[model samples]
Target: MSSFDLTEDQQDCLQELINVAMGQASDQLARYLDTFVYLKVPSIEQVKSEHLFETLNQDLKATAVVSQGFFGYEGIRGEALLMYQPQDSHRLADLLGYEADELTFDEQIIDLSSILTTTFLNVFASQIDNQMSYSAPRLLSANQGTISEHLNQQSFNWDLALKVRISYQVTDYSFNCDMVLLIPEEAINNIKAVIDRILEDF
Candidate 1:
């Protein structure tokens, strides 16, 4: 893997941390919605940042998007994105406690993405034992091409990114969304080191 100086064992250990982070995200959603939230098993992948949209296109349509950039005191930094198709929008709207047709579809997407991204950042920052802060998330045009296209357009040519994707559904309703966390390759080594330290402590 292009995980900087991380070893195979360290990679496995790093995933354990991600599992915990996912759980935290799940719990937050369940409590906020006051319903059971089922998070599918998450998978980790190492790929060029440019390949993100193409790779995820098979499973994600990304008709809507919310993107946020984050950074921490220890120098670990990157962005988090939440994307879903129009068909999946109503489900997400309901999960946010809105009637399917109540809010402007774009409004619902913004609300949903903001909630998920904040929860993710909290758990992730806590796990890595760093003080990470986020910039105000800017809503983007859904008409924009694939998510990868947006990233490329931004001129952020990342060589590699570690992607952890989890699909979640609200058990009480037919609502589900895919959450993808992208950590740059440069941050992976620092993240691995942090997770390793946590494992050693326990």
Candidate 2:
């Protein structure tokens, strides 16, 4: 089997691609919420499934996580998770113009996750000349446990995951969230091939 790791050139190419995609997603999100969105540089790396959450630089304590699965051509597939810190939930509710009731809050969380996941992945897939389909976004945990604990309970078919981490913050508001893409080992080779073709074209 091919190695899951990407070459330096492939990594650079993929990161650039994701940067462009994220820019578009950020624009759409800003328009949707009528607020400026701040984005951090996205990082991509391969990590053991067990150490997934540990790789993040941010403290993910008391997070509410929503996960959605997406698949595309060339075996490009993975699960995308949007994690929100509960402390910002009220701010998010305010931005959405919704009451901070539990039911409405939960519904808005899923709605926001769906928007972020679909918009980002759709742009990313289009860049690679592919289309993606998504599964319903489900809430994994709601301010109940650590992000690591929530993920540990779930089973992953692959040992290694290509994790792409992107963080978003709304200007002048404490609303912040992290979007993570977990691509299995088997899909890494496919992604590498696609990156190679893109590099060749440039």
Where does candidate 1 clash, by residue pair?
none
Highest lDDT scorer = 2
Q: Model 1 off-target regions past 4 Å?
A: 1-5, 91-93, 98-103, 143-145, 148-155
* Model 2: residues with Cα > 4 Å off, grouped in runs: 56-58, 97-103
Candidate 1 residues 69-155, lDDT tens each?
888866677776777666655566667887777887777777877777778678867887777788777666673566665555675
Provide the TM-score for each candidate, comma-separated.
0.82, 0.91
